[model samples]
Target chain A: MSTNKIDPTKWVDKYSDYLFNYTIVRVNDREIANDLISETFLAGLKSMKNFKGEASERTWLISILKRKIIDHYRRINSKKGQAEVRIKYSDDSNEGDWLEEQAPDRLDMTAEDIMENEELGLAIIRCMENLPEKQAKIFKMKTIEGFDTEAICNEFNITPSNLWVIIHRARTTLAQCLEKNWF
Target chain B: MSKFKSIFVDCSKAGNCCDKAQYNEASLPEKVKMLVHLALCKPCRKYSNKNTKLTKLIKDCDLKTCTEEEKQAWKEKIKQEIALKDRG
Candidate 1:
């Protein structure tokens, strides 16, 4: 709301926790996440004039933060100069180290059942990360974006039939991952 | 599973998990499909819905804002910047 354009100070006061939690949720390393947060705010200040307020300020800022995190990983991968980075955006996923195992009975659960099942919820997030690239894209498009068929096909460059295949594959993979890992 | 001669999809496109229509048109054919694999298997239906609900809850919720210490630090930083701006 300041006349001077991007208010780094305002963004810091407003969304720092959101940004912190968002980065920490994706990047496990505290120092790396903090560095990314700082850089996101720094970059956001530089680009604030260009933001144009099309999306919510939060979305704009988070988009910058996410891009920065992706860049961080890219830098590390390039440093190694490997074929590709092993980082599948799955690095922060919690493994089985946290909780005592019970069973895969969540397969028989409803929304209420699983939310109450916090362990199961964490496991499901991990399972989502393990999905194949195409399948993960489909699931994210459908489940997260709430996109209908035509839009998704256009975004992913596949026919509706192919879209169906991808979603099916993703659902199957998710089910299996949940059963084996967290269920 | 029995493969059909391709329903409306002629040239044998790769089979999908389930078509979008199956999600809605609960016609006999839709019932013949798996979204309702639940009425036949309520447990699995329960599981699928559970996942959907969890995702919705997370996506549609409030995200917490900056903390007290963070706010204080931000104010102090802003004050320092303003002082420098005045001096300039």
Candidate 2:
């Protein structure tokens, strides 16, 4: 028997940001990422009946998104006719020196760095899932969105002290959760 | 004893100040008290270090959230698709 169940209505609130962050980095365009995510959500809905309760909803959606991204590249590649490879040797005098210079700087994000950051980002969001609904919302507003204290207080109808308490709890929980895997 | 009491803050209060300081929201006096507490409190200092590291990790991760309008648009699309499926 499957251990997980699908709930389409809550997918946006629960996974949109995770999906957006995952897609934006892969596609490198906001509009294209958004469109792809929209398509992923629709595709997920179509396949809802096929979902076994084995994997969690987020994991299942991500699998569909991976295929969507692959398909996107496949479409673009087909439109470009044949594959082409280009190499540059602007300075013959320098020989191999220019090629070495053209290599990525040490400070640039390597494929490994990108992969680690992606995993870290997703892990943080996953830790957030363990928080109470209200605490997670407030923490995201305060920490991620960078809303002002008074503004958040007014929106949530809570005092600054209450907000701080919630933020403290959220931070403590997140730090503990991440410590094992990330910290 | 009384003077020390004025500067002394419990661990929870120290934690609150540390959390506020992470966001640059702690007042100077609050920060001073928190620091004084950390100077004498071993666990609070450890907690403060971990808290600071957590803040840096969060900042370094560079996570982004979608706007409310974007989320609403997605929700609307999902709702529409579900409704259409029902009719079809």
lDDT: which candidate is best?
2
**DockQ per model, Cα:** 0.15, 0.79
TM per prediction? 0.35, 0.88
Error of 2 at B60 (Å): 1.1
In model 2 chain A, where is the ten-residue run with the lowest total lDDT?
Answer: A94-103
Off by over 4 Å in 2: A81-108, B1-4
Q: Write the per-residue lDDT of candidate 2 for residues A1-183, one digit (tens) a residue.
A: 988978999999889988998998899998899999999999999999989988899999999999999999999989886767677788787666757787778687778987898889888998998899899999999999999999999999999999999999999999999999887
How many Å off is the CA of B82 in candidate 1? 30
Return the DockQ of model 2: 0.79
Give the TM-score (vs. native) of candidate 1. 0.35
Residue B15, candidate 2: C-alpha displacement in angstroms:
0.7
lDDT at A9 for candidate 1? 62
Task: Give Cα-based local distance difference scores for all models.
Answer: 0.57, 0.92
